[model samples]
Target chain A: MNCEQARPLLAAYVDGELDTVRMLEMEGHLPACPACTRAVRELQQLQQSLRQESLYHPAPAALRRNVLAELSAQARPEPKPAFWSWFRLVPALSGAMVVCLAALLAVTLNRPSGHEQLTAEIVSSHIRSLMANHALDVVSTDQHTVKPWFNGRVDFAPPVKDLAAQGFPLIGGRLDYLHHRTVAALVFQRNKHIINVFLWPGSEKNSAPSLDSVRQGFNLIHWNQGGMTCWAISDLNPTELLEFTRDFAL
Target chain B: MEARERLPAFEQTVLPHLDAAHNLARWLAGNDQDAQDVVQEACLRAFKFFGGFRGDNPRAWLLAIVRNTFYTWLRQNRPAIPTVELDDAALEVADPAAAGEALQTRQADAETVRRAIAALPVEFREIIVLREMEAMSYKDIAILADLPIGTVMSRLARARKLLQKQLAREYQTGGPS
Candidate 1:
């Protein structure tokens, strides 16, 4: 592998694309040939420097909001025609049918018990927060700032800790309406992902945290700790979200 | 599937590559505002044709649309200027002056490097950005740029060499007095 033969293949060798035979051939020539070795080193250094360069520009938050809003607007279901006009023609029969329907609805709406309803509420709240660009009402990472910010907004103080060293940094907190009452939503960051931890006072004693359910690619973990029921939801993988809840439970 | 059903799949698979698409568009469009426009256009197009996208590489798929959208944008907005054509013959001939100064000790600043890249012909600039900055493989870049693998390799080599020459010139001019 003279310099001429080796020069063209140096880029490939640096990129780790060469076959084993070619790699061995290049390795054999590098010790004996100073110029080829330097060329290979230069290419490697150039590639490394380029990778380390901060050249990637992220899409602005406004762009993300705009794109999501456009998609949601397009996906909204069309409204059905009015049923009042048809019912007006047969008022006496309609009144009796409405009474029967109300009785049936009372039974059907009661089907989802407490836990299932809470799971659905938290999941929808997470999705709405993301889609509406309202993930955090107060944006601060300091646990002191975030924890105190929840005062006067919600009845109970949500525990806030900076788990940044553990790869889950506290983002901030927000007041969210869930379970027919106001709850504290302490937001956290896992890389670019957002995790919403909803906290409200619980009547029952402490219980072990466990995976509650998954809906629309978001995972939910429900647990009771120190007289508070915690529901943490995120699109982040289940294992990581579990680890997060475990850290919070401690 | 209904459009609403498809929205979740698109958000899970394709929306994550927004930064990658924006970065490529930023380089191709040469400014942040134009880049945003190009990326938004590309994303809408990607959503409309997402049913046809069967490949696993969502980033590459999104970037291909970005590249196409940028070219269409350039054609419509900057129609008077001809498409840049690299002089392969000239690039093949080595400039001995540049070759000698290329091994200088002085380092080029980030500004110099960026200016040099922005100064290159769009053809060279895009290939360099894809291969060097984006760290894409030759095959993926070829698909994105719609060029042969051999062409991609040769173009990248030339682009790097041109960058080195530009850096060498900066070093010679701005070295410690």
Candidate 2:
């Protein structure tokens, strides 16, 4: 490859993304080409100097307090009745089954199903929405203005309400889809925790409000309110979430 | 009892990374105060979604949030970038030539390089901070910056070249001397 061709691959080469053959070819060109060789040396030095500098500094004490407070404020207890229900059924199923059948049931219960993975996928959607600039296309507290902003963006208007009087102030509304259907995420804040309330119209009775807790240390509360299903995910305590939900739902 | 016991364990695993989160925030936001706020907000958001994080690298996960928070704040505030007027009184001495000599002598030390790195443009400073201070892989930096990995690599190359040139000018003029 010519210098023009080799320039772009240089970065991939440094990053170890190139295959063996391409890496060997780049290495061959490096020795003969002064510019390519200089580029490699300089890039290495830049990487070294950056690694050598002090990047990780302790946050101010007050800042840590602020973050914790924000977290504590939004945390609410998730409904874990489903897990208990499932566990409760496990013992009953074993007692009724024959000894041979009991062994077969054990293998089935241990494996994670597609529904559990769906929860992970939903949380990922939440993370990506906040990561990208699409958090709120129209930033406002006016329900009339924020609710209409989703028009033409999605198929329906998400229920936007003003809960500021309840201490969970309305930030704005945005269009988001989850669980193979168009969903509305109404953004609100209790102190500093931006609560993401995912809403979708469903008639399944919301499955008795189950709390799915991940072993990696995240919490999710899925409940059915009115005609919509609400999945409240946050790092807050389940008790805190329950309190917030009780107040917000009222 | 089960829920009560889980909180402390989760905190122990995740809270320790707060400082590293703040440092990346400081670099992205370009100030101590904004850095504090941005990192705090990111922490809350990360905690809320902590369930989705799985068992992977928490540091990288948290840093990505901090980086995103800074960009969000930057867009909201749209705060005017305070220009580093080289025309300041402390920089301007009786003799134009003496300033150069003094900068060189004083800047040869690592401390000066540290300060100089902070004084670069936001784009330049971010690349320097991510590459040097954070020791992030180019791919990681690209992912965090929302740029292609190739752009991250080239930007680092240019950032270093500019920083070195700036240091040379500062030192060669004897400003730090």
Candidate 3:
């Protein structure tokens, strides 16, 4: 790879984004070339500096507490199985249910085989929102406006608080559709950090506090607080969320 | 496996990625509280569809959920607020400390770098977080950002270039607080 050609690939090389063949080719060329080496060195320094800046600032503890509390509130109300349809006797109902059940059955029967599909859905939703520009509906710093806005749109009222005084201000509210029902999404901002709190009815059957973390790329903080489950998602480190939640109050 | 047995496995595979999800949510939401909300919402969505997760990277899946939750929240409520400058002084980079205790924290100079990163444009910053901080591959980044792999590489390169420039600017301006 010549200087001009290798220059573009330097970042990829540093990142190991190149395949083995490309990597070996770059390696062979790099030793004989000072310019590319220098360029590579500069890129490395730059990346290190950027990495240095990757310090995470977590969501405030109170926000987690408040969100969890709000979720727990609605969680106590178990979802009554869609009023056992008299339609169950109808052939059409049975047929439709059969199809849905088949799909569900296939999934349930092969839980381990569906990890990729599940991840894709999660990623798909994330990309969809960014491209679609429907990230938030209610835009306000007042919790009052955010909390009440969801009254009719969603079945449960999400706990909303304005943390403006504490540096994270309440932005408006919006209705989100998830788990087969409308849920409340309360928005907040901390510097450049945006917290999206989704409140919905939790399963009364599984009320244990649960937590999960993934490191494929972004960091996720998912925990069930009280009866309400809260997932604090961000690229920020878990420690930051811990700090944020520590200081967060409803 | 029974739904009962499968539930724990789902939790085991996906739950470990919650912090990663939370971090992504925090960056997208631009605040701790909003990030929490996004993470919570994403978790529910993730849980409901846990059965659909096949053999794939769970963290990216969860992050994808966070990203979706953030945008969904934005659409239904407010537009994404651009990360504003908190006056140069408040963000002024603290000087490298001379003493022992402060030196330890100052060694990496991570805090200042973080603030500088926070100040970047969302388009640029998101890629940076996904690639460098989170260490996602080009393909995964493409999937996450809905961009092509070429675009991901170029964007990540550009993001790095911008970070270097920002660091240089910080150095020239006497560092951030």
lDDT of 1 by residue, B6-76 (tens): 78998999999998888888888889889999988898888888888899899989999999999999999
TM-score of each: 0.56, 0.45, 0.49
Best by lDDT: 1
- The lDDT per prediction is 0.82, 0.67, 0.63
lDDT digits (tens) for residues A105-212 of candidate 1: 998898788878888889889988889789889999899999899888887887788898889999888899999999999899898889999999984698777888
- Which pairs in model 1 have colliding backbones? none
Model 2's alpha-carbon lDDT is: 0.67
The DockQ of predicted model 3 stands at: 0.11
Per-residue lDDT of model 3, residues B44-141, tens digit only: 67666767788579888877777877778977767556444424343343221212122122222676677667777666677887877788888998
- Best-to-worst order by lDDT is 1, 2, 3
Candidate 2 regions with alpha-carbon error over 4 angstroms = A1-19, A29-36, A53-56, A60-250, B1-13, B81-109, B175-177
The TM-scores, chain A only, for the candidates as listed are: 0.57, 0.48, 0.45
- The C-alpha stretches of model 1 lying farther than 4 A from their native spots are A77-250, B92-107, B175-177
* Candidate 2, position B146, lDDT: 84
lDDT of 3 by residue, A8-52 (tens): 888899988888988998999999997677667666665666555
Question: What is residue A93's positional error in candidate 2, in angstroms?
Answer: 54
Query: TM-score of the second chain in each model?
Result: 0.89, 0.73, 0.77
